[model samples]
Target: MKFDKAAGENTLFDNAEFVGRPTHRIDGPLKVTGTAPYAYERHDVVEGQLYGYPLGSAISHGLIVSMDAEAARNAPGVRAVVTTLEIDPLEKGMNNVARLFGGAEVQHYHQAIAVVVADSFEQARAAASLIEVEYEKGDPADYDLGAAFERLQGSGEMDTDTGDVEAAFSSAAALLDEMYHTPSQSHMAMEPHASIVDWSDGDQMTVWTSNQMINWNHGSLATTFGLDEDKIRVESPYIGGGFGGKLWLRADAVLAALGSRAAGAPVKLALPRPFIMNNTTHRSETVQRIRLAAGEDGKLTGIWHEAASHALPDGRGEDATAQTPFFYASDSIRAKHHIVTMSLPESADMRAPGEAAGLMALEVAMDEMAEKLGMDPVEFRKVNDTQVNPSNPEQEFSDRNFVECLDRGAEAFRWTDRNTAPGATRDGQWLVGHGVAGAYRGALVLPSGSRALLEGGKLVIETDMTDIGTGSYTILAQTAAETMGLTLDDVEMRMGNSAYPVSSGSGGQFGAASSSAGVYAACMALRERIAEQLGVEEAEFRDGRVIAGDTDRALSELEGQIDAVDSIEWGDFQSEYQMATFGAHFVEVGVHAGTGETRVRRMLAVCDSGRILNPITARSQVIGGMTMAVGAALSEDMALDSGRGMFANHDLAGYEVAVHADIPEQEVIFIDTLDPVASPLKAKGVGELGVCGVAAAVANAVYNATGVRVREYPVTLDKLIGGLPAIG
Candidate 1:
């Protein structure tokens, strides 16, 4: 709450101010101590809650011929047995892109078919296994994306171009064309999707669970149930991890609500570990094609990106072209998506969504082009750099220091270790290489609102925003405390309740700036009221009190009267300014010549998120995202069983993610910057910056070590061994 007197933007205060200081996450203790409860464990609200266990289909795609609950009903402690026929049919949630349990037709493997309610969790599980159901199986569309991909209609969009690409390629002195593929991925957050549903006296209901976006889900759920929005309350105090999986309403919520209403008691439901992959959502798989043509000077004249993907019949496009139009300066450029309908579980957003997958392909392509030109990849990008977005020439960037990021990273990573030729650097049995990549993510802010109370000098802020284990509590505390000119403890922050004003929940890396701005707006209102009550100029208000020429009144004295006024709200400033974050990732790697195993030796990242509300939390966000990117580049993939059309490794043991040992000594640095156009605090989102350009750095390192070209994700060992020239 304290700012260095000389620098106004050094602490947690007003303007595009107080962005460079380091602060701690406001909600750390509650998360580490196990005191904060997740979804189904809300033992505080529902007494004698009936646990509901869901049963999934054995076949990937099929029709439910019939279901018999006699055995389940006869099971011990059974309270109720429900299926599609018995429970009130649910309308699809607005947040759900694909229909939830759409009609009795099973869409993918392990689709939940029925639920059993019992006195205890053990009883529910045991009884659930007793239900008998029959399915009429049918051949499912397999995960043969490679074979199936070629047959795509090629109709949605191919993204062909401005100046004739044929002429550009024919006349160009340098050319590079290649295809890249990335396998499907899972969120795999620590806490699985869960929901606890309880009914109030008549038509009222309350649901406590883990979700990233509360306001959207609240409205979506209300619309789905055809109930009054005020009658339902949703609270998600802390989320284990959402990635992108928890962005929408998972089946657990809809089923628990149905089960609770039927059992005449509160119902608690959690998706079993194995079912998590198929029951909920996962990142969509993509195959991209990159074709680039450059002149003798290595200036790109033509660049085209065509991305193909599969999803449920009505699934949304991943739009991997986000960074393409802004990456470099080119006269002719093409970027688009070709989507196909496949028999599979729903695929939605993950960490960086498009940027995560797009950068993997684009950066690697740039590296390959750099090698062909015998140019340093860092310098290659800088030479063709763009100061403004190519697609939107009118809306220039607020600040683009991508060149400095690359330069600093190269110096820190010691670029001299890497030579122009691959397989030229070796240390014993390891092929040593150093690589660099540019990271970019745009910051977005939507209108967000919050309500606060000032009682006896202690300030309390309330909003439906969720902490989501992303430091929502701490950043919010900083906002209020700074606004009121008080210490961190002086601000009481309440979030994760739908009874409060609507909010911009934690997703798309907008949570910090957008949500805190809502808190800042409300606090500004409080300051004005305090100034009027103290009979002083609004600009003169300071330090929990106000001053006039000869008069002084404590801020607390006017609070009682101001409390009688209506709650405060904020206006939209996101419209005027372009907010975004930029960074660069540099890496050193070692490749085993014998086994082709890729190991990270060292990593460093430089970021330019507008502000740093809490340095401790911001560092954690960067590290976590960097780790995920490393997984995407090195070893995390959801292997699919083509014949069954199901995730071959449906459980955690089969699906691999980054563990502590997988990460090297990682360092993150933030370049201090502020944007008055964004909000009073000027903090851009830091949640997803860690992952933006990571895969490219790893891919570049692999090429440096062995001179092999790989466009597939995870950069598996088999890929390298086959391309090697008889390595002994």
Candidate 2:
């Protein structure tokens, strides 16, 4: 059935036995025991598979004058060397801005220029170092953010203006205008971008890669290689993690396929850690300036969120203000984004693209505005909450419980006992304080299809959807079990193969809701087929038994196997209602008075993202998001070398993510809500929403502890040391 209207009271969902239970990941044991086969580890996948190592350009911005691979080609065990200089320039994918294998003109530092195939990984690595290349610097690299800011231009499509923001600000009783900066960040997934390619007689190629979107990467590979879509296939059943890094086709797959063709054998390639940083995409650096106007009663009158971020010459800027227009209620609001063209590495989505960065600025500004009005941050947010779109009052939100989220989070975090005055609460040499921030991420659904087959009392579901450690296998199992009245073990799940039906393919935090909805559609068809065989109009299956009004039989007693395939398409509800996920974050922090060190003592998140499909997996997602946001608040930043135009700290040791010791006890509470407009499942995504306003919450806590307002990200000790009260 097409989901064109509100799913008014789904009796199946209400009667579900496992849909909302805490089901563990189905692939957990395989991953925990180190039996899960990653792309590079599949050495036995093809006969005589070769190893390929990519060589990146040494210079950042330059023209490749000449390349000499004779010595490397003649070296030991070298099967073939494919250089960009000799190969035709490949077409850039639709989602990509920079060409993965640009021959002469290099767009950024560490761009792949060649790949060497050899008998072993060591031989390929050693031979790669022998290839000599000559480069001539083209022009001064545009690495300065300030310089790029001067050239910022409005993205005409993303710009939104409702009323006179200036007039509202001028008449407001309370106002604040501030500038904040967020530096470039890396995905830093546990597994690197790796691929293994095998080609057949007809030039039909199969790529076993670690990617998030299967169909999207397949289309990209076909486009890049100038092959028909049917000739290329992509498979990625299990992903260590993506965090939006593996959404598009990267060089690993392309280079592996190209090297395999050159060497006349299957090839495998895994990008080194350094190349993962400079060669692949990273989140762009942003300079945001937010202006908030509020009344004496703490109600917002106007809000202006304007941000500028650096992207490549042909790259579209990050939509840093995408969440502002709908997050809070304001009479006059203007949200604009400016794209600054620079020579930096291409920018793409990471976690919650617009909302993550936008809230880092907007939420903190909300706290500041509240302080200006002498009100509590939670109270300020509750007062400004809107059930309708702030920019377009005619559009109503399908469901919004932002105030409840804030109130619940405050109560769970024990806000009433906290000291509002800075440095009033202390333990020995540490000063303690609390902070709160609101979270918002829009809900989206895509056309997704699935196939379900029943044989010997067991059902198998197949789709191209991927599980990037977000528990796709388990949630889908629960969905199928709940729909077909079977145990989790009775459902066999198969996915991440191009042969399966196309799915949404796990990105933008929409994987769980969209993919499961597709599964539901397929299972419904199977139920109908089963009922027809029993000669009944309606049937209900419970615990391996099918029951119609008068007829009942065990599933195994059925005469033949049943199979069905179906897809869920977008409906009119999406056009009529504004769908979004809402949550609130509360944090308690302690600051060392002497050394100016800050530590998060506790964190609690209250979310209202509709129908927690699997409590364990959903909670895990929120906890992971909270941990990542802690890194963004305290230590994550990729340093830029303007002179060399490369990321200075390209390795994991230099790039600091939050360690286990850095994290505190975290609590996640899901408000029992079912948004009928989201999908047949009545569930929305909570992954990105988990990180939405987390950083601002941590930053606000720091301000309450040390009385310092740090506008930049990774609120380091240096920023707080200057304002710390003199040590006793």
Using lDDT as the measure, the top candidate is 2
Q: Can you write out model 1's per-residue Cα lDDT over 681-719, one digit (the tens) per residue?
A: 756787887898898888888888887878888888999
**Model 2: residues with Cα > 4 Å off, grouped in runs:** 150-158, 200-202, 725-728
lDDT of 1 at 594: 83
Residue 96 of model 1 has an lDDT of 74
| Clash statistics: count for each candidate | 4, 0
Compare the candidates by TM-score and give the number of the best one: 2
Clashing pairs in 1: 9-18, 23-615, 26-474, 443-580
Q: Which digits, one per residue and each the tens of the lDDT, describe model 2 over residues 1-728?
A: 69988888777788788898988889999999998888788766678889999999887877899999998999899999999899778998768888899579887888999999999999999999999999998788666775555455334553789888889998999889898888888989999999999863457898999999998998998899888989888889889899999999999998999899888889999999999889998888888888898888888888888888877777766777989999999998888788777666778879999888888888999999988899988999999999999999999999899999998988888898887987778888898878888999998888888999988889999999999999999999899988988899899999998889999989897998899999999999999999887899778888988998878888877777799999888787588889999999999999999788989999999999999999999999999999999999999999998888889899999999987898869999999699989999999989899899999999999888878898899899998898886631
Query: Clashes in model 2: which pairs?
Result: none
The Cα local distance difference test for each model comes to: 0.76, 0.88
Candidate 2 root-mean-square deviation in Å: 1.4
